[model samples]
Target: MKLRQLASECDEGPCPTVWTIDEDAEHVLVQGFKVEDEEALATMKMPEHETTVRTPMALLKRVAREHLT
Candidate 1:
């Protein structure tokens, strides 16, 4: 699948970013800091194929305003 960058918080290196699937605008791909908190992670049951990341609320709002809207 192709990807189009929607927004990024960094210029160089790994940072919270959002991407849109070129083939489907209804869904988005996210890049964020890896969540390694054992206590927090243990609170939920996630399938082996799925994982989680952490991002800021401001970034999410920006995505909603610019893309989702």
Candidate 2:
């Protein structure tokens, strides 16, 4: 999927690391910055493997529905 479309689906905040049409892919990428100095935010890379894996929105909705009742 296109970056803009992926971006649109996200909640209002910083951009996500990885946007994928297939959530089951090997990795879920996210875009972020590293604060080398308190006053400076430099663009940095955050690999999916480096952090906790998150449930995709589609999956979350399904799970919510299953237990909501």
Candidate 3:
């Protein structure tokens, strides 16, 4: 599947970012820091195949304003 970048928090280097998958506009892929908080992890029923990341809300808001609309 192809990825179309929707938003990025930084101009260079590793940072929180968002992308659209193949031609599906309804769903998106996010890249951010890995979630390593033990207390937070215990609240979720995450599967072994799935993992989560941590990012600022501004990253999501930027994508929603600039790309989702």
> Which has the greatest lDDT?
3
Model 1 RMSD in Å is 1.3
lDDT of 1 by residue, 36-60 (tens): 8888788877668988999888888
Worst 10 residues of 2 by lDDT: 35-44
Query: What is residue 65's positional error in candidate 3, in angstroms?
Result: 0.7
What are the C-alpha RMSDs, in order, of all predicted structures? Answer: 1.3, 9.0, 1.3
Q: Candidate 1, residue 3: CA error in Å?
A: 0.5
Q: Write the per-residue lDDT of candidate 3 for residues 1-69, one digit (tens) a residue.
A: 999888899999889999899878678899999998877787886778989999779999998788768
Give the clash count for model 1.
0
| lDDT score for residue 11 of model 1 | 82
lDDT string, candidate 2, 1-69, tens digits: 433223322567654334443644443344444334422222335444543333346544543455344
TM-score of 2: 0.24
User: Candidates' lDDT values, in order?
Assistant: 0.87, 0.41, 0.87
